[model samples]
Target: MIVAAVDAQNLVDALGLGSIYALMAVGIGLVFGVLRLINFAYGQLIMAGAFTLAYASRANWSTWESIVACFAVVIGLSLVMDLAVFRPLRTQSPATMLVATFAVSFLLQSIALLTVLKVQGQLGMPASTVARLSQAVTIWGVDVRKVTIVSIVAALVALGALALLLGKTTVGLQMRAAATDFTTARLLGISANRVIGFAVLLSGLIAAVVAVLLTARTPYVQSDFALHDMIYVLVGVVVGGIDRLWTATLGGFAIGFASGVIYGALPTDKTAYLPSVLFALVIVVLLVRPAGLFAPRGTSTVERV
Candidate 1:
């Protein structure tokens, strides 16, 4: 019975983590689809949202108000980034854009660190209002946090809504065309700026949602709140096939679920090595499926727009 209970708990936790990672993957993959640039600064968007929630909580704001602030901050910063950094660098080499994102990531982290130190004189802030979701309810003799269910449902709903946007909307068609061949799409009268802006908007919205869900699990907001998870999700996206969004999402969920299970299974003392073990497995998976584990067998490395 003890072992069975532990297994059940692990499964639930894995699914919860997987759902969060899947959302993160979608945010990354969406922008990648249109921009062809991997934004290393993506995590900072989540961090920004989390900080918004933290500040709101400190001010005793209503839940809805806090959520609104989070979305507003994340989305606003996303557009600023698109305009200030990405737009000018759009014509540059991929390496240049990639390095720029790295610089942006560090800059954002430094800003957050400095701002928090100056204002709060601390390295972290508690988003206590959103922490209520961490409370657990019993289900079939197992306890499950509300955030777990919310994460899973949110992912499904977001994905479904995105599908409709992409499949049924005209702008979605233009975005698809741009992703496939930007030069051709531009020649066909598609506005590159519009398509990229919409993609960044959608990505920022998803990041805000991820911020809420993650804060429920770990209510303390820090400069590096989502940084490590972003790294893992990036690896998972590549392992699952970054060229395609669906595969990249699956890759994110796969890694998150695997990490949860591995952590649960390892002895308490050995849990510190989880990253080493997990990454080692990732290396093996890449060796076996260089094109991506979920990608079609014959899929080429060529950009799949």
Candidate 2:
């Protein structure tokens, strides 16, 4: 009975964790597909959105209103970043762009800390929001947080919408073309700004979604709220296969699921070892499949999203 109970809880946690990471992966993969840049600053979008939520909560805004504000702030910031920073440096070396993103990440984190620390004693969301999200619902005699179900549903919906956007729409076609070959696509009349801007918009939207779910699971809105999570998702993208969206998504889910299982198995006091074990496993996987665990043998490490 004890083992069964533990396994059931682990399964729930795994599904929830996988769902969050999968959405994050899609956002990262979208930007990567077009720009070929790994955006470390992506987490700042979530941090900004979370802070928006925290502010809304402080103002006693309704839940729905807070959610809307969160999305707006994240998407708006995303556009601004792309237009002001990334657009100008489009032709720069990849290393330069990578460093730029890292700088942006730190800048945003510092800004968040400086701004929020004075307003609130520390960075955090409203107690009511956390209590509401942490509320448990029992299913078949097993208990799970309401947010877990929401996370899984949101992930499925986001993935489905992404598939439709990529497979059916004209912009989607342009995006795929750009991903396949940015220079060739531009020469073929696809607008570089439009395609790339739209990609950033989509990533920002995903970040907003992540902010909501993450805030619910962990209502403490800190400067580093999404930083470590983003790092894990990045690793997952590399592990699963960063060349294609599906592979990257699967990789994120795989890493999250593995982490969930390891976390569930560990004693509370030993939880700090989770990262050490997880990274070790990642190293082993990389040693075995340097291209990627999911990447096909002999294939080029590039593809359309």
Candidate 3:
């Protein structure tokens, strides 16, 4: 009975974590699917939103106001990034574009760190901004965090809406064609800039949502807040199968769920080994599957962000 209860709790936590990670994977996958860029700076978008939320909280803004501010800042930054850096290098070699993103990521992280230090002397967020998200609710004699429920629901809603956008909308069709083959897409009269811009916009929107949920869960709003999660999601993308969107989503969920289960099962003192174990598993999986754990055999499609 004790073990069952523990397992149940871990399952709940895993589901929540999986939801968050899946959202990230989708965001990263969207950019990659269309742009063929890995976008190492994607996490910085989330960081920007989190800090926006923190600033809004400090200003005594309402919840809705803070959310609006967060979204605005993240989306705005994403557009600027695409226009100023990514757009200019669209025709460059992949290595060049990849290195450019690495530089952007570092630049944004450094700027965020210095700005926070200058303003607050440390990384911080208003306590009230996240306190309610950690509150627990009872369900079938089990207590679960409200944020977990929100996270799962938000992920589902966002994914569903995104599916509609991609499946039913004209721009989404263009994105799909572009993802299949950018050169062909351009040949077919699709506007490359428009398609790329749409992908970045969607990616930024996803990042904004992630920022809200993660901030509510952790509330620290630190400089490196999303960096570690981004790394895990990136690895998950590769492990699941970067060539396909569904596979990447599954990979993200799998990693998040595995992380939760392992963390819950570990002795508290030894929890620090979680990353080492997870990465080691990733290495083993890569060694065995080479392509990806979720990728179909004999598949060889040129893929990307």
lDDT of each: 0.90, 0.87, 0.88
TM-score of 1: 0.96
Clashes (candidate 1): 0
Best candidate (score: lDDT):
1
Clashing pairs in 2: none
Q: Distance (Å) between predicted and true CA of 189, model 1?
A: 1.1
TM-scores for candidates 1 onward, in order: 0.96, 0.95, 0.95
List the candidate 1 regions with Cα displacement exceeding 4 Å.
1-6, 302-305
lDDT of 2: 0.87
**Which rank order by lDDT, best down to worst?**
1, 3, 2
TM-score: model 2 vs. ground truth: 0.95
Model 3, 1-305: lDDT tens digits are 32443578888988899899999999999989887888999999999899998888888888888889999999999999999998999898888999999999999999988998999987655535656788999898777898899999988998898789889999988998998888999998999999999999999999999998888878878788789999999989899989778888989988988888888877788889989989999999988887788989987644443
Candidate 1 vs candidate 3: the TM-score winner is 1
CA shift of 55, model 2, Å: 1.2
Task: Let me know the TM-score candidate 3 reaches against the reference structure.
Answer: 0.95
Least well predicted 10-residue stretch by lDDT in candidate 2? 122-131
